[model samples]
Target: MNHNYKGFFSIVLLAWVDADYKFMWIDVGGLGSQSDAQIYNQLELKECLEDGSIGLPPPSPLPNDDQDFPYFLLGDDAFGLRAYLMKPCSGRTLTREELIANYRISRARRVVENAFGILAHRWRVLLSTMQQMPLTVQVIIESCVCLHNFIRIRNPAIQNIQLDNEDGAHNHVPGLWRQDDNLQDVDMPKEGNRDTVAATRQRDYLKYYFNSPVGLVPWHDRMVGV
Candidate 1:
C-alpha cells in the first residue's frame, strides 16, 4: 500500500457534486498527497468547455456590463484561482469587501462539503480508513459515491433529512465560517503567480457584486465583521 508520491499508502478522491447532493463526477485514483488544485487542473472540465459540451452562462451583467460572466467552480484556498474556478480571498488583513466576498464564496462551497459529510455518515466504510490496496480502496470509494447518487435519485426526499446538524445552522446563516476537521490547509502560490490578469479582474468584479445591494444579504456585514 505504498504510494509513489508520498512514500506511504494513500489514495485521493476528487469529486464534484451538484446542489442536490448528487455526485456528478468522482476521481478516486489520485495520489493522496496531491493538492486539490493539481487534481482539479487535471480534470476534463476544461476540455469539455473547449468542445462546447459544458455550456456556462456569460459573466454577471449587473456587475460588469462588458464582461462575460464565466461560470466557475467554487473551491477553498487549497485550490488555485482561475477564470473558471474561484478560491477565497487570502490574507490576514482583508478589507471588508474582501471578507464579504470570502464569506459568500465559502457559503456557496459548503454544498460540496455537505455532500461528503452525508456520504460518510451514511456509509460507515468511509467513516473508517480502508486497509485494502489502493485500487480496491478506489473501487470502494467510487462505488459508494455512485450508490449515494443513486439513492438520492430514487428517494429525493432523503435530501431533506439533515445528516449534519451544522449544515442546518450554516445554511441559514450565509457568512459563518465552519472549520472542517478533515481539511488540512495547504499553502497556495503567491498572488502574483496564482491567477492571470483576467482572472483577477473577474474575482474583483465578483467581490464588488457580493458587497453590492444585489448580492448583499441582511446579515452579511455582521457575519463577516465588515
Candidate 2:
C-alpha cells in the first residue's frame, strides 16, 4: 500500500452519496497501495450496475429533448468514464460548451464532496490516522457513517448548518467544516481504460444538452465566463 509523505500507512474510503448528502453506499479499508480505480473495480456495486440489478432509474430524455440519457454518477478524472459514470473532459483546449457542461457537472458534484467534508468534520477521528487494527478501524468508519445518516434522517435541521449553502447570487458559502482542518484528498493516477467510444458519445450528448435552451441554467454562462 502507498504511504503518505509522512511515511504512514493509510486507507481509502469510497463513498456514494445522495442529493441530500446521505451515504447511500460505501466501501472502506482499501489499502493505501491501491488506486481509486482499482478499488472501484472491485466493488459489488459495479457488478450490480453492470447486471442491471442496482435498481437505477431508467434512462429518460432531458426536458424538451428526445435522446435518452442514463442517470449517472459524477466523478473526477481519476475514474473511468462509463455510461453510468461521467467525468469532465480532459485537456485545456476545450470548447466553450464543453467547459460549461463541465462546470455544471462540478456544481452537482459538490454535494458528494460536502458529504465527505461533513463526515470528517463531525468525526474528527477520521482526520487523523487511527492506530487501531484494520478490522477495528473499519468498524469505526462504518459506525460513523451509520450515525451520520441517523442524525441526518432523524433530524435534518441540525445538519443543515453543517452543510455549505448558496447565497441569493448563487455564490457558494463555505461550510463550518472549511473553517478548520479537514480530510486530505488522495491523488490517484488515471486509469488505463479511462474513456470508451460509447462513453465519449454519451458525454458529448450531455454537453450538447447542457448548452441547449432547456438545460442551460441562468448562471451557467456567467459561471463559465463564456
Candidate 3:
C-alpha cells in the first residue's frame, strides 16, 4: 500500500472485537508503523488471506465445521479495503444483509478499538500529527501497539476476562470483554499459549486491542446502490 503522504498515510492495520463483540475482524488506517508486517504487496495479502501464514476465524475456523462463513470486512475510506471486500463474496448480495453482518462483526471486533484508545490515551503519540514521513510514522505506531499489548498482559486489569466456553456464536455480548477491575502490575506471558487447535483462535482473540477502521464503502455502496 503506497500511503498518500499528501493525504492519509498508510494507517496501522488494527483488528479487534467490537464493543458489541461477535465474530472478530480488523481494519486499516489507524497507525501505519506495522504496514510492512501486513504485507504491503497486494499479491502477498491475497495469498496470505487465501492459503498462507495465518488463518482467520469464521472464514477460517477450526477443523470441524459444516458451514463456510463469508468475511464481512469493514473499514473507513482509507485502507482501500472496499476493493478487497467487493470481490464476489459467497451466495451474493441481499438488502441490509451486509450491514447486519457488519454490525455483528464489528461488535465482535471492537477490542482493538478499546485497546487502541487506551494506547493513544497512554502514549499520546497516536493523537499527534500524521503529517510525518511514512517510514518514521509507521515505526512509532507499530512500536506503540506492541507495547500496549505487552503492558495489558503484564499488568492485567483486575477482572480476568473469562471467555464463555462458546465462541459467543449466538449470544454476541457487547462491551463485556473488558473488566471493571483496576489493573495491577504483573508478569503477563509474552508469547501466546498454544494448547489446543483452538489456541490459534484464542490468540486471534488476544491480538490487537486497537486498530484501523474497517471500510464502510461496502455498506455505502449497498445503501446508495452505486
Candidate 4:
C-alpha cells in the first residue's frame, strides 16, 4: 500500500463559529496536507488574541477566583494545546476528571461542526468535490459560507434545521466528528507535546468549574458515563 498518495489536491477550510453556530471568520487556503494546527498558526488569530478584540464576555465568578478565565477555541487531538486553543486529553486511560473535561469540550466544539453541516445543506455546491482550480474552489467555498451566514442572520428560522434526528445514512447528529479531507498528523516538539503549565492550569480550573455549582450540569456524569 502506497501511503504517499497525493492524487487529489485539496484546500483547508478553517472556520470559527459563535455559540449560536454562525460563522464569525473563515479562512480558505492552505494545501490539504496541512494539519489543523499548521493552518491555524498561519491565521491572524494570534493577533486577535493579543489585541483583545475577540469580544469575549467577562469571566464569571467561579469557585476558583484566583485564575483568569479567558475565551478559547476548542479543537481536537490534531491541534496542539495552547492558552487560547484547547484540545481534549490524549490517550484512553483518562481519569474521571479528564473524561468530564473531554465531554464538555466536545459538546462546545460541536458548534463548528454544526455550522459546517448547515453550510453544506444550504449550499449544495459544497456537497461534492469541486472540479475547478484551487483558487476558484476557494472563492466558491467562501461565497457559500458568506451567503450561509447572511441567510442565517436575515432568516433566524433557518437556524433550526432539524439536525437532531434524520433518516438513512444521515441519521447521525449533524455536528458529530467526521473525518475531513484535509486531516493530517501534527508533529510537535517532544518537549512541547504536553500542554503548557498555564494551559493545564486553566484546563484544571475549568474542570473544577464544570463540577462546581456555577457550571455543574446535573446530567453531565450520566451523559459522559464517568
lDDT pick, better of 1 and 3: 1
lDDT for each residue of candidate 3 in 1-226, tens digit (9 for 90 to 100): 4443334444544443333322133434443333322333343444565463445454643223333333434432223333122211122464343444444344443444455445555565666556777667767766766666665557645212422222323443433322323221211112121133443233223221111134232333333333
**Candidate 1 lowest-lDDT run of ten:** 184-193
Cα distance off (Å), candidate 2, residue 121: 0.4
Candidate 2 collision pairs: 1-33, 2-32, 2-33
Per-residue lDDT tens digits for candidate 1, residues 49-114, read 546578777656544345457777776665556787777888899999999999888777778776
TM-score of every candidate? 0.77, 0.91, 0.40, 0.77
| Candidate 2 lDDT over residue span 1-226, tens digit each | 5473346787778888999999999999988777677888889988997788999999998788887889888888778888888988888799999999898888888898788888888888988878898888989999999999998899888777877887876767987776764455533455655587888999999898899998887777777877
Model 1 bad stretches (over 4 Å) = 1-8, 46-53, 57-68, 163-193
How high is the CA lDDT of each candidate model? Answer: 0.68, 0.83, 0.39, 0.67
lDDT of 4 by residue, 8-49 (tens): 456767777887778888888766666556666667875676
Candidate 4: deviation at residue 121, Å? 1.8
Q: In candidate 4, which residue ranges exceed 4 Å CA deviation?
A: 1-7, 50-68, 165-194
Best by TM-score: 2
